[model samples]
Target: MNVVHILAALSEPTRLTAIHIIWDGGEHCVCELMERLNATQSRMSRHMGVLKAAGLVVDRRDAQWVRYRRNPDLPQSAACIVDAVIAATDVAGEVAA
Candidate 1:
């Protein structure tokens, strides 16, 4: 995936938060994401679409729930970029709180 596309997908706060959650290394249900981010189902789904299009994440249908996680096959460079963004966001979050 193009770095520009990935960066663009993560450029928004809601999307970034979603990425951060997924980066923690487990599949999360869409409903769980909505609760964590305080977002509606539609809003979470929209952000997830952006991330999916960027090839940073993948989803699977688990019965009634859709689960999402970081794409394990992501290129090394892309993974590094994601890690960097997460790190930066964590530091920024610490400062804000």
Candidate 2:
């Protein structure tokens, strides 16, 4: 995966949170993400498109719903970066709260 592309895709807070939720919870439905992230369907889909384009996540149609999960074949370095970002953001969130 192109690090620059992946980094750019993850630069947004909503996108970053979506990744973290998928990373921590495994596959999740679009509706669930919408509720948890307080985003509209179209907004979540747009962000998910960015993640999919970055090779960081994948999705499949589950009847009427779309489920998303982290790409299992993600490069080690990219995975490390994602983990680091999640860790840093989680800490920052905790501190801010």
Off by over 4 Å in 2: 91-97
In model 2, what are the clashing residue pairs, if there are any? none
What are the TM-scores, per candidate, against the unseen true structure? 0.90, 0.89
Q: Looking at model 1, which ten-residue stretch has the lowest summed lDDT?
A: 88-97
TM-score, candidate 2, is: 0.89
lDDT of each residue in 1-97, candidate 2, tens digit only:
7989988987888888888889974889999989988899999999999999999999999998899998998999999998988877763363235
Task: Output the lDDT of residue 21, model 2.
Answer: 85
What is the lDDT, from 0 to 100, of the residue 43 in candidate 1?
A: 89
Off by over 4 Å in 1: 90-97
Question: How many backbone clashes does every candidate have?
Answer: 0, 0
Q: Pick the candidate with the highest TM-score.
A: 1
lDDT of 1 at 38: 81
